[model samples]
Target chain A: MTGALIAGIAAGLLAAVLHFAFVQSYILLGEQYETGELVHFQTPADHATEDHAAADQHDHGSHEHGDEPSVLQRNALTVGFTVLLYVAYGMLLTAGFAIASQFGRKITATEGALWGLAGFVAFQMAPGMGLAPELPGSAAADLTARQIWWWSTVVATGGGLALLAYGRSILTVVAGIVLLALPHVIGAPLLDAYYGYAPTEVGAIFSSRVLGVGLAVWVVLGWLAGRQWDRGAAA
Target chain B: MTTTTQTKTQSLLAPILGMAVIGLTVLLAVGHAQSATLHDAAHDMRHATGFPCH
Candidate 1:
């Protein structure tokens, strides 16, 4: 529907705004630590200045770079990519909404907030339990392995939640529960040895804030999409 | 639902699949693609949104 498209665009812009306001600074700080500008866990006895002690054993596959990108200069790319991300989320959200509506389940603007939370659960919370947000220079499991786990977890959680939300019979609900639990049971791939350039303190803050921002943005997205869908229904 | 609503929407399958494919592509490109250019281009968002990043 045009409603969902408009909603998606609106939500994407809002999400980017929220990201700029609340999330960008921490990313900048993490990058500083990532590039040897700041050091963490240093003690006076072994205070090693000018030592790239945190030499970024980070295995960012295919992230080789000849020169570092200038910080704060590429606002256009950041905003553009973020909008694209949320637009995608919006499309997916409304697609689910349309299917539910077709099945005789009507969605309201208020109910859409719940859908947003569900989206967060499926997309952000579920996968996050396995792979907490990471900072630059932080050690992570293999790229391909983690991606596979993350994508699977999102699909499983979304499908499971959908069943629980829409299912009437016990059997369907039970199947939903199974899908929800499958990924966590398998566990996310993690690094065997942990080494990182960023401080644990910064990492901790950044991770939680990412989730927090995700929650807010997703709720708004759902609400906007739902409102538009409802308007179409009323018309 | 109104008659207008019914007329405006078609079989749900087509739209659902269409949107799902497009949305997934955008998400994958922004969040998971392995290209160095994409990673650099989306560095802030990649980190801010909790997608797995270096």
Candidate 2:
């Protein structure tokens, strides 16, 4: 247990580092678009002045001294937030791994990577199929409804994958498949029509890139956590 | 034997419980926290992961 916890912390930190290095810039870019700093699929002339005024207000509020946050401060906050979130993620992953290990499976880095991929599929890709990623100012369904759907999908997918991967009987596999499909069958709540301030293409790119980064982080997290757990067990 | 079985069960239960507690705390914090800082951090993450946020 101690080993698993330690492994989780380490993996979370590393995944945060990877996120900072590869994923943060895209997010920042999307935020800029979301907040109207940059315009796409629309003429700049339409909103240029309004955007600048908004930007000026934002700048004053966020960076009052006319000096932007130092690179160090920005990186620290990004890394700190990523680490905080990933640590929770890592702990859960590690715990799940522990449960799996009870079934006589040997924990290995490759297996960890596979588990990570499953996690990415369950938590991000599956929900994303319905919700997709949204930029800051994009239109969305009711928050309560979306959250409920997202959580249910994650639970169903995760549980389903676990059964599919480990279940010995055909019945179990079938049940797993059903659980996996049930969410989509019910479908996520959607607005009557698509509405958003950002361009569709920007949202698409943001969604895909976020998923890509999630995949990489999960793989690394799983590999490292598994290796650590195994080593701790051996010790 | 009963004691050993009970111990084993507890061992298995502990991690799952821990995960559930932590996961729910995060979900609540990210979804409904009153603090802007917590909300913003989680909001950024939601966007980062492509989870929908208006």
Candidate 3:
């Protein structure tokens, strides 16, 4: 029991860290497209029909946001909730592995990585081409929507295949996909008036690359998590 | 020794099943009672936590 708890904590931390890495990479890539003028920034400011005040307010707040929380921040509450999310996700995976192991099956970190890849291909890659939401930061970029979709699909499928080729299996792959999709299925308007139209190929491509990188990060994280869980059980 | 092994096994299974039951019950009740509200909150939480799925 002690071992399980320790393992759970370790897995949670590792996954969280990996998630941070993916976010940073996506952010950086987005900056590249913006600064390079590869994509035009389209804002409500550019359109006379939209509310400039709302757009300006949004931009100002985002640009001025601090890395550290304010004194009035619910730091403890945030940490507690974050920890709960991580531990719960970890526990679910660990339990799944444990159950699988009882069936004379063995899963390794590599297998976990493959599962992560599948998640990218199915949830991020496939949907991203047409279904994923574009980031506000990339709103003004000049890339076409179809281009973005295609690129995203290529990255997702290709990256997933690369991960699977390294000796992974079906279970983790499927689990990762399910994990990626669950929150989406449960939240946000499925059909938002904001992104009603299909994305251009360029937009899809850009989104795919970003998502591919994210998938890679997730695969590594999941593998590390699984390895840590196994170590805890043995210890 | 056999009885001891059985007791240990029972102890482990007990908590696992208990927690699972609790989780499932809450999940089902939430699903039936206020799915939209639950979804909205979960979505907001996921975004705040920087979950990449969205």
Candidate 4:
């Protein structure tokens, strides 16, 4: 357990570093697009007044509005919060690995990588099928509703995958598949029409890049957690 | 034997409880965080993990 905790912290730190280096820029870019500084596309009802205000701010080269944090402050908060979030994620991953190891599976780097991929699929890809990643200015459904759907999807997919992987009986496998499909069948809430400030291409790139980075982080996390756990068990 | 069983139960329960507490804290912290800070901190993650945010 101590080893797992240590590994989780290490992985979280590493993932935080990687996120700061690679993921931050894209998100900033998306924000820019969101605020209309780099408009690639616009709808007929696009808020010209808002765009003009943003343009004025851009021309003044000042973002120091009241309650607006400075770049330094923003980046600092980003780092702190990201580290906190990833540490929690890592701990959960480690705990999960510990539980799985109790079932007699060998915990190794390779298995860890697989587990990481499974995490990515369960948490990201499966939910993404219904609720694709959104940019800052995009339209979305009610927040509470989306959150409920997202959590349910994550839980069902994770549980389903575990059953499929470990269940010995056909009944279990079927149940797993049912759980996996349950979320999509219920469906994520959607807007009556597609509406977003950013271009489709930008949203596409953002989504793909986000997932790509996530995959990398999870893989590293799993590898380290598995290695540390194994070493601790041996000791 | 009873002591051993108690130890085993505690060992199992500790990590699970720890995880639940940590997870809930993180979720609440992010859920109610300041918009911009939350966006920057979790923007990539929210997208990467398929949590909808507009």
lDDT of 1 by residue, A1-235 (tens): 6776787778778878887666666666666677776667668644553233223212121223447554335667888888888888888888888878878888888878789999999989999899998877688998899889999999999999989988999998999999999999999998888988877776787788889889988999899989988998889
List A-chain TM-scores for all predictions.
0.86, 0.81, 0.43, 0.82
What's the TM-score of chain B for every model shown? 0.76, 0.59, 0.48, 0.54
Fraction of native contacts, model 1? 0.85
Off by over 4 Å in 1: A43-72, B1-10
Clashing pairs in 4: none
Off by over 4 Å in 3: A1-83, A111-214, B1-12, B15-45, B48-54
Candidate 2 colliding pairs: A133-B50
Q: Which pairs of residues collide in candidate 1?
A: none
Model-by-model lDDT, in order?
0.81, 0.70, 0.43, 0.69
- The clash numbers for all candidates, in the given order, read 0, 1, 29, 0
* Arranged by DockQ, best first: 1, 2, 4, 3
TM-score of 4: 0.80
Worst 10 residues of 3 chain A by lDDT: A190-199
Chain B TM-score, structure 3: 0.48
lDDT for each residue of candidate 2 in A1-235, tens digit (9 for 90 to 100): 4554565566557756655555555555555666666665656685554345334433333322345555456556655655656666666777777778777788877888888888888988899888887766567899779888998999999999999999999999999999999999999999998756666655666677678878887777778777877786688
Most accurate candidate by lDDT: 1
| Model 1: lDDT of residue A98 | 82
- Best candidate, DockQ: 1
User: Which sections of candidate 2 miss by over 4 Å?
Assistant: A1-22, A39-75, B1-6, B27-34
lDDT string, candidate 4, A101-188, tens digits: 6677777878877777787788778888888877666678887788788888989999999899889999999999999999999999
